[model samples]
Target: MLTRAQVDENDTVLITGASGGAESAAIQLAKARGARVLAVAGESKHESELDAGAQEVPIRGCPLQDQLGDNGVDVVIDLAGGPNWPELLNV
Candidate 1:
């Protein structure tokens, strides 16, 4: 995500699919850098923030898209930027 998003202190990263290891690590580092980390994932994966140090935002259906609006995200760490990504991007 840094390669593209260029994460900064004021950036807020909304990490979809928070259960992955690499993305989880990235969220942790982003938060440590003083960025607000909103870890979005399925209800079952909400407990992961204990180690990632991110504020868990459970998406019963589509939480990231729900939180995101017309403007672009400061940084989006999409674990699976496949077909479902458009839903979040449209936000």
Candidate 2:
């Protein structure tokens, strides 16, 4: 999907649950392809995601909607999908 979407150095990618298998791979691949990778994962998994080449968007004590402002991310790779599904649709 990343390739189909033409994700490149100019893109900002948001990968949720990035510590998991699929998301983790997506993060690494997207980064390798030159996109700016922003990841959302458990507080404990932040370091791992960083190691995989993504910037963490702390989701623990912080409000997610606030962290993600009006201008949304260019691409979203969601592995742990939930209510955030609808939110992503809106974005």
Best by TM-score: 2
Write down the RMSD of candidate 2 (Cα, Å).
1.9
List model 1 lDDT by residue over 1-91, tens digit each: 5646667787877777777888788787887777777776767777775467776464737644555544345776777566667666664
Residue 49's lDDT within candidate 2 is 82
Looking at model 1, report the run of 10 residues with the lowest lDDT sum: 63-72
**Runs of candidate 1 exceeding 4 Å displacement:** 68-72
Runs of candidate 2 exceeding 4 Å displacement: 60-62
Steric clash pairs (candidate 2): none
